[model samples]
Target: MAESGQDQTKYLKGPDQIIPSDVLKTWEPMGAVKLKMTKSGVDANPPISVPSLLRRAADKFPDVKALCVKRDGAWKSITYREYFAKVCTLAKAFIKLGLERFHGVCILGFNSPEWFISDLAAIFAGGFACGIYTTNSPEACEHCAISSRAQIFVVENQKQLDKVLEIRERLPDLKAIIQYIGKPTSAGVLSWDDVMALGEKEPEEQLDYRLSCIAANQCCTLIFTSGTTGPPKGVMLSHDNMTWTAHANSVNIDFALGKEVVISFLPLSHVAAQMSDMYMCMYSGVSVYFAQPDALKGSLAATMKEVRPTVLLSVPRVWEKIYEKLMEVGKSTKGMKKSVATWAKSIGSEICERRQKQDFGKPVLYPIANKILFKKIKKALGLDRCKIFISAAAPISNEILRYFHSINVPLTEIYGMSESCGPHTVGVETAFKIGSCGRTPPGFYTKLLDKDKDGNGEICMNGRHISMGYLHMEGETHEAIDDEGWLHTGDIGHLDLDNFLFITGRIKELIVTAGGENVAPVIIEETLKGELPCIGNCMLIGDRRKFLSALLTMKTDMDMDTGEPMGTLQPLALDWCKSVGSQAKTTRDILEGPDEKVMRAIQAGIDRTNSKAISNAQRIQKWQILPKDFSIPGGELGPTMKVKRSFVAEKYSDIIERLYDV
Candidate 1:
């Protein structure tokens, strides 16, 4: 034992022996989520509040560029010190504006520095931060605001402000609205500058007190679900949930401190984007550049060329579009250019195949092909410095992955939901299988429950990164997380011999026919798209029905400005039409007045898909091509490009009825 005023470290055996008794006592558990702390787990996570993490970064890398925003054709950089100062000032402003503890500061905007500051400030002020999608309707925005009981709402521009104002009467808890972009047109609305000015008048004592009160186990943020099946549920994320996952991801991805760069474009409302763009970056001292608002609408490539991010996280649809555009451009190449490209692709494919089999040895001709072909392709796509390509939030087809690999770019798939803090299992470049979603990170555990004959079962995970619970929904929270503290992810998957998790389908999305045969629609739908080159989107339907049928949309040009599908077919679709000997130039031209050759070609593709079906009931007995492709604006797909099955079924009830009627 040490004397009262003596140094205690001299008596300790190791760092582990110096455990503070108050550390565990300080934990504040939420709902039914009890803290599960082990020496190793605590060592990995080191329970800390969000504000402390930001403070650590600021103290270590004060002069390092933390954020970059483009304005007047020039990039404006803000250092870590400046970022932290702004966050603290804004938090003081939030406290001055009467931000009640545990209430939300709802941010509705694209990915920007202001949005980032607002989110952190809310947590620092002892309030939870909630992100609202920019593409959400006024009603949808109101739903989120009400659910979170938002005290302050931050919008990007006048358009987003107008939405909140329209539903202002319904939002009783809303205390203020701040517009970050332009001058506010409405009365009582504060400009971004106004909020900063207000902070200058307030003292830091209140803010510091609030920050001290923050506990790692307390909910600091809310991630609203995309609501494909039903109403969106607010996912309550504790401070430890965000911080632990960020640290774990930093270790898993081998993030280089003060070196890695990334572009922020995906909706900040999403967990994947939030984790990568905000939490992960802050945790690893990575700098971030904000892309233009129209990044997803054809401007992403231009932004990519400018940023040249070290790591890129994109949805599968974006990857597919890039693949299609490259293939379309390749079709015009002739002579030696085309031959060298072909040779390079072959070499690239051979290397990728060997890499997948754990044989990373390069072929003899790889260097020659890489210099003449792969390097140029990577430079053109602005991925020259991109070391890691990640696909998440949706299932990416093996075709898309192979196509990327053929260009010397391999996409690694990450698997998780909002409930898991966006990353549970992640694919590493060295130890990854092409079709699998990699292995779980450190301090995380996964198990399959109620496995089928083939060993596929519902995937469940439990870890420090797991969410606290659903916000204010006790029944739903109990259903999602069992008494054993395992998050029962509705997603069905199987772990291979190497522990690579392969997602098969969702339990709710499974179609059980009247004859009692179960069918996973995703595999069937993917097979159809593989068979038909012209088909853009496919949805299989036969739930509680006699036989299976599919609804498909032909590949068509999308309006980059509006994100809507156009009547004209894409160049590849046209090439496909010509290959089948059809003269049709548009989907309407082929559908309104059916072409014999095109119909026969489609029939052939369907027959091929049917040949692979395990049972007659699993086969698509009929399919109808829609007039337009599925898009975000059309409400067929979510912001993450996930098809809303229930919404589609409700919208196309008559079309679905017609298929079964026959």
Candidate 2:
């Protein structure tokens, strides 16, 4: 990748960073708005401590409840003073336990006061904090623990603690396990209370100076990217990376999330949900209503009703589910409901398109449909009070975007990853393009690398938001970043004539057709996913064959109309036997049960889908869907849920041979 500088602004500078002309054009407007608003003292640092943010907000509104920790089925308040004391105690204990500056520490648990506290304590104690997703398999968890070489880990309960212990022998650096929430772990383990006891024995002294070793530019958080391709790699992010993330969000949209209620339902492990739900909530002093882990929809609505959250963040999969539900309801209705739903979708798409025409006014709407259909949809999703809905992690379909837009929900599309510290680019309804991602985020310099005449190239950027580097992978870092210090993002996209970005596909995810045509899987995946939410994902499987085929997984429904589990809660073998004509479409050779009904159904789906594909890239034959779901342990997936294509191909070579031979 060739890195070049085309400077327009003298203010933004780096090794090879340049201020895009489009960025310079909006500098004045951004400056005016930034100048008019005061920068929050939330990010004060020699330490870049997040606890400092809570303290600042607490000082402003001391009586205002800082955090409401729910436990024993009762809502309890942790006032500012109490919260600070708890954090300080944890920080002191961590110091007493040999946690020093820049040491990697892991937080392995669900979202709780302790999770947040441990994260703050680690940063305050001057170590990089890593948050691992709770749902990660034992192997996935061990991979992260080993990768980071984390000396200290803070877990919530025994199950989490046991998972650590199971992998403890593999991770020699794992010295201590701190239980923040739940009953004290087994007698053999040193509990969180034991650490607190150490702090209780010492008198408080020199709080600020002890944390002086940490700097604003120092590595703060090392988040693991859910590796779609291979092993999960750690993204080293500085304090500035996190701070600029909050600033970028504030600058681009009118999402005054700080002063309103916000809900935390997403996994704090992911950057999109974490940055918005955790970092943003902490800095803004927003009331966060965390829902129960199992009760997503019910708890979501309950939390929404209780807190009346004005800010929301979700992935497109969730939106797709809701959109499908809404359509199902509309389809089931007679005249008015169907018309209302249809009109709402139409008007929403129209309003979204008009905003692209540079019109900035109240969105035109059919008031009756807006109130009855759109408004109701918003309330049902617990998004009535929300000023904006931000979607990321994956590409959202334009149809889904328009569906929510019609209901007066402004769908803001954001693009970034853990490597970016958080999202670096986002779109507001007013400035967004339907199919395009959006303009460059604030505090980042974006440009296309290796572009041809039409300016399509791999997207690269340099800014405060850029990650520090890959943890313990200098060679990979050298491969990813160039000599000029730009992160060569593997995404392919172009800046349109209007300066909005339209992502074409991933450079790495391209497939070659039998006719020697280069086709992008991401484009086809997005299109197919948009069309059929029920068809989980489609893998276009033609490289040098006469045509292409696909392996399909179905969108599962846990609860049915009867309010019971959709599939057999019995044994996997029994379930497989029963789900004969169900969603069992996968590679043929990997098939498990008797070949009576399922074989016919799988073959039928493949045949129907093949008719849609052209001659050289069409499915000629296939096999039954694999009985196992993809995972590291299952040997079908990477840690980040990306299919292990080569592994799968090799594993089912026998079946693939039969299918092709015939």
The local lDDT score (0 to 100) that residue 300 gets in candidate 1 is 91
**lDDT per model, in order?**
0.86, 0.62
Model 2, TM vs. native: 0.80
Q: Tell me the lDDT of model 1 at 34.
A: 43
The Cα RMSD in angstroms, rounded to one decimal, for candidate 2 relative to the true structure is 8.4
Tens digit per residue, CA lDDT, model 1, 320-365: 8889989998999999999989989999899888887889899999
Q: Which tens-of-lDDT digit does each residue in 1-662 have in candidate 2?
A: 11113222343222112222211001111110001112443222122335455566566545555566556787777755566677778888877777765576788776676776677777777676888887676788888877766778888788788888788788777767788765674755667778878877756653343455444444567788776577888877655567556655655665553366666667677776668766776556566666655433334556666666687777665566567666666655788767667776677666666787876554455675577676777777677777867777777778778767766677878787777766767777678877777788545667898886768888887665666567777677777766555778898889988878877767776667667765655565555555443444456565665555555544434342222223222232233434554444332322445455655654555555455654434334444343433333445553234456767767766655655574
Candidate 2 — worst ten consecutive residues by lDDT sum? 24-33
Give the runs in model 1 whose Cα sits over 4 Å from its true position. 1-33, 41-44
In angstroms, the error of model 2 at 304 is: 3.8
How far residue 631's Cα lies from its native spot in candidate 1, in Å, is 1.1
What lDDT score is found at residue 293 in candidate 2? 55
Best prediction by TM-score: 1
